[model samples]
Target chain A: EPEVTQTPSHQVTQMGQEVILRCVPISNHLYFYWYRQILGQKVEFLVSFYNNEISEKSEIFDDQFSVERPDGSNFTLKIRSTKLEDSAMYFCASSEARGAGEKLFFGSGTQLSVL
Target chain B: AQTVTQSQPEMSVQEAETVTLSCTYDTSESNYYLFWYKQPPSRQMILVIRQEAYKQQNATENRFSVNFQKAAKSFSLKISDSQLGDTAMYFCAFMVNYQLIWGAGTKLIIKP
Candidate 1:
């Protein structure tokens, strides 16, 4: 089975620094999403990207957060100014279709630690 | 606003035994989807099963099955003949308009 690949399995960054998380979704997948899970908390949706633009985003996604599908292959999430609260496991997922019941393929999340 | 609830925070069962994980959700939309995802120690999220709200028949995989009650708004997962590999954190999710609302998750431990 195809899988979504995320780079830098573990990232440690200083507070107020910029950090870019990269992901390579499956070759044929069309829809992409970003979700984060704080320790002991439920997963929270950040944003969804399709057709080179954001389809929907959660309140957790604010001005400091931005997503880009550069070169039609790598989908990147950039946090201009990281905060201590930004520490969490970020997962990248992709689906072949946008159907209501389609399955999503997720990467082995990138754990980000902001100090 | 939609929310999924997993009543059991953790459960344990002997290998080859059967285990059931409970999940309930709240939503106003009539048409939607429900999903079960398992995250192993590796932290990789894998799809276990899914059900479409419009479908009356329950969905089943090899050793995983769901008891879906539409009117009651409940979706529970049953794992029969459990194995050690089945140990993971299971999350129940509700989906509508391509957005998934997740639950706090239930941790299942399969002991040999």
Candidate 2:
């Protein structure tokens, strides 16, 4: 089955540096999302994208966070300045539609470590 | 706001035995969806099962099944004939109002 794919399975960056996580959603998917899970914490939603725009975002998605669909297949999440607290497992997910019962396919996730 | 709660932090079961993971949620929306996802050591989130709130019948997928009580806002996962590969962190999630709410998670260990 086709699945969402993310690059840089693991990333290590210095604090105050910029980091960009990349994801290639399923070719036919229309909606994409980003979620994060701090070690030992529940997965938290960051943002959702559709039609090349952000549909929804959580409070944690503040000024430092932004998402872009630079190309038809690539979706990227950029953090202007990283912090220790930003270290977590970042996951990319996509869905064929926005239906209530539709399932979202998730990638293996990129583990972000800030030094 | 919608919140999903998986009270059990961890659980264990012997191979071939059965185990059930409990999940409850607080959602005001009547129409929604519930899902169980498994995160193995690799940290890959895999969808295990799903249930639509409007459906009365429980959803089952091979050895995995769900006891979805929509009125009580409870959803539980039951794994039958468990295998060592079943050992993973299970998360119960709910989708409502176009957003997904996740539970803390239950770490399940299947011993051989």
Question: Each model's TM-score, in the order given?
Answer: 0.98, 0.96
RMSD of 1: 0.8
Error of 1 at B85 (Å): 0.8
User: Model 1: runs farther than 4 Å from truth?
Assistant: none
Best by lDDT: 1
lDDT of 1 at A56: 92
Which 10 consecutive positions of candidate 1 chain B have the poorest summed lDDT?
B93-102
| Predicted complexes: DockQ each | 0.89, 0.79
Q: What lDDT does each candidate get?
A: 0.95, 0.94
The number of clashing residue pairs in each candidate reads: 0, 0
State the lDDT of candidate 1 residue by residue for B1-112, as single tens digits.
6899999999999999999999999999999999999999988899999999999999999999999999999999999999999999999998877888999999999999
lDDT for B46 (candidate 2):
90
Per-residue lDDT for B4-112 in model 2, tens only?
A: 9999999998999999999999988878899999999987789999999889999999999999988788999999999999999999998875677899999999999
